[model samples]
Target: MAEEELQLEDGSKKKKLFIIIIAVVVLLVGGGAAYYFLMGSDEAVSEEMTEQGADNDSDESLTSTTVKTGTALYVAMPRPFVFNVPGSTRDRIVEIKAQLMIRGSDNEEKAKMHVPLIEGALLRIFSTANADDLATEAGKLAIRESALKEVQIALSEITGQKVVEEVLFTGFVMQ
Candidate 1:
C-alpha cells in the first residue's frame, strides 16, 4: 500500500511539472508577441517614407504651377494644438498654432473641410514626440517636417492631390 501511495505521489508531481512547463512556454510566447507588437516593423516605416518622398519629388513641378496659377492662401486653425508629450522623466505640455498654405479657393475649401482629419493626424504625430525631440532645434525642425508630411499625406488622400504647400507654425510653446 505504501509503495502504491508513493507511486501516486510521483504521478501527481509529474502532472504538476508538466503544467509548470506549459505555463512557462505560454508566458514566453506572450512576451515574444508583446515585444513584436511594441517594436512593430521598421520596414513599414521605411516604405511609407519612401512613398512620401517619391510623391513629393514627383510633385515639385506641379507645386510651382499651383503657386503661379493663383494667389497663395493660408488657412489657420480655429485653435492651437494643446497636448502633453511624454519624456524620460516626466510629461511636458506643448501648444502649437499653425497655418496651412495652399492655392486657389477649391483647395482652401477642401482644407477647411478636412480640418478635423488634419488635426487628428497632427495630434498623433505631436503626441509621439518626446521631450528630447522638442528640446533641440534640429529635433524641432524634424518634428515640423514630419508634421508637414503628415498633413500633406492626409490632404492627398482626401483631395487626390497634394493640397498643402506648406505647414507654417504661427506659435509654439512647450513646458
Candidate 2:
C-alpha cells in the first residue's frame, strides 16, 4: 500500500511539471506574435503611405500655345515701393516691386487692353500686400497669385475678352 501511494504521488508531480512547461511555451509564442504585429510592419506601412501620397499629387504642366498668327505684346507692371489704399489709414503693402507681362493673342484687341487697365489692377495688388508677405516664400507666392488675378481681371474688363491666361513675373525685388 505504501509503495502504491508513493508511485501515485510521483505521477501527479510529473503531470504538474508538464503543465508548467506547456504554459511557458505558450507565453513565449504569444509574446513573439505581439512583437511581430507591433514592430515588424512599420516599414510596410510607411512604403504604402508614400506610394499613395505620390499618386495624389498634381500632374506635370505641359506647355502649349493658343495664339492665332499675330504679334505678341508684353507690358511691364508699374514699379512701386508700396501702394496705399485710397481711403484706408494703414499702409497694407510694405513694398510692391515686381514686373508682370501679359501675352497677347492674334487680335490686338485683347492685347491692347493690358496697357490701360494694368495700372489700376497693380494698385489693387500693392494695397493688398503686407510686411510679412514681403518677407517669406509663401507670402511671395501669395502676392504673385494676387497680382496675377488682378491682371487677369483687368485684361477681361478692358478687352471684354479672356486676354491673359497667366501673369508672368518678369522681375521681383521686395524689401
Candidate 3:
C-alpha cells in the first residue's frame, strides 16, 4: 500500500510540473507573436508613409498654396484679472484667468515677450463686460472674441503678426 501511494504522488507531481512548463511556453510564444505583429505593422506603416512622401514631392506646390498653421501653444497670464462689473441689481466682483493660444515657436516667443501688453488688452475687454452678460454663455463667448481681437491687434502692432490666435479663459468667478 505504501509503495502504491508513493507512485501515485510522484505521477501527480510530474503532471503538475509538465502542465506548468506548457503554460509558460504558451505565454512566451503568445507574447512574442503579439510583439512581432504590433511592431511589424508600425514599421510597415512608416515605410509606406516614406514612399508616399517621396512620390508627393512634385505635388508640394499645389499644397503650398493653402495656408498651413503651426503647432498650437498656450501662454498663461501671470495673474488673474480681478474687477467689478455693474449688474442690474448690484455690482459684482469678477476674476478671470486667461491664457493665450498661439501658433508656432516664433509666435510663442513673441507672446511671452509681450505678456504685459496682452494682459492689458485682455483686462480692458474683461472690464467692459456687464455682470449680467457674463452670467450667460453667449456673453462669455462675446467677451472671448473681443479679447482675441484686442490681443491680436496689440500684438500685430509690435510683432507685425498676430501672435495670439485665441484668448482662452481657463477660470472665471463672479461674486
Per-model C-alpha lDDT, please?
0.83, 0.59, 0.84
Cα TM-score of candidate 3: 0.62
* lDDT by residue (tens digit), candidate 3, 1-175: 9999999999999999999999999999999999999999999999998887666554643221122278889999999999999999999999999988777897788899999998888888888999999999999999998888888778778877767767889999999
**Better candidate by TM-score, 1 or 3:** 3
Superposition error at 60 for model 3 (Å): 25
After aligning candidate 3 to the native by TM-score, how far in Å is the CA of 82 from where it should be?
0.7
Off by over 4 Å in 3: 1-68
Error of 3 at 2 (Å): 51
Q: Mind giving the per-residue lDDT tens digits that candidate 1 earns over 110-141?
A: 99999998898788788789887898988888
Q: What is the TM-score of each candidate against the true structure?
A: 0.60, 0.44, 0.62
**Cα lDDT for residue 97, candidate 1:** 95
- Please identify model 2 stretches exceeding 4 Å from their true place: 1-73, 78-81, 84-97, 105-114
**Ranking, lDDT, top scorer first:** 3, 1, 2
Tell me the spans in candidate 1 whose CA falls farther than 4 Å from its real position: 1-68
Better of 1 and 2 by TM-score: 1
Model 1 vs. true fold: TM: 0.60
RMSD of 2: 13.8
**Model 1 global lDDT (CA atoms, 0 to 1):** 0.83
2-82: candidate 2 lDDT, tens digit per residue = 999999999999999999999999999999999999887998899897785565344322111233234456544445445
- Candidate 3's displacement at residue 131, Å, is 0.4
Among these predictions, the greatest lDDT belongs to 3
All models, RMSD in angstroms: 16.4, 13.8, 7.7
**Model 1, position 9: C-alpha lDDT score:** 100
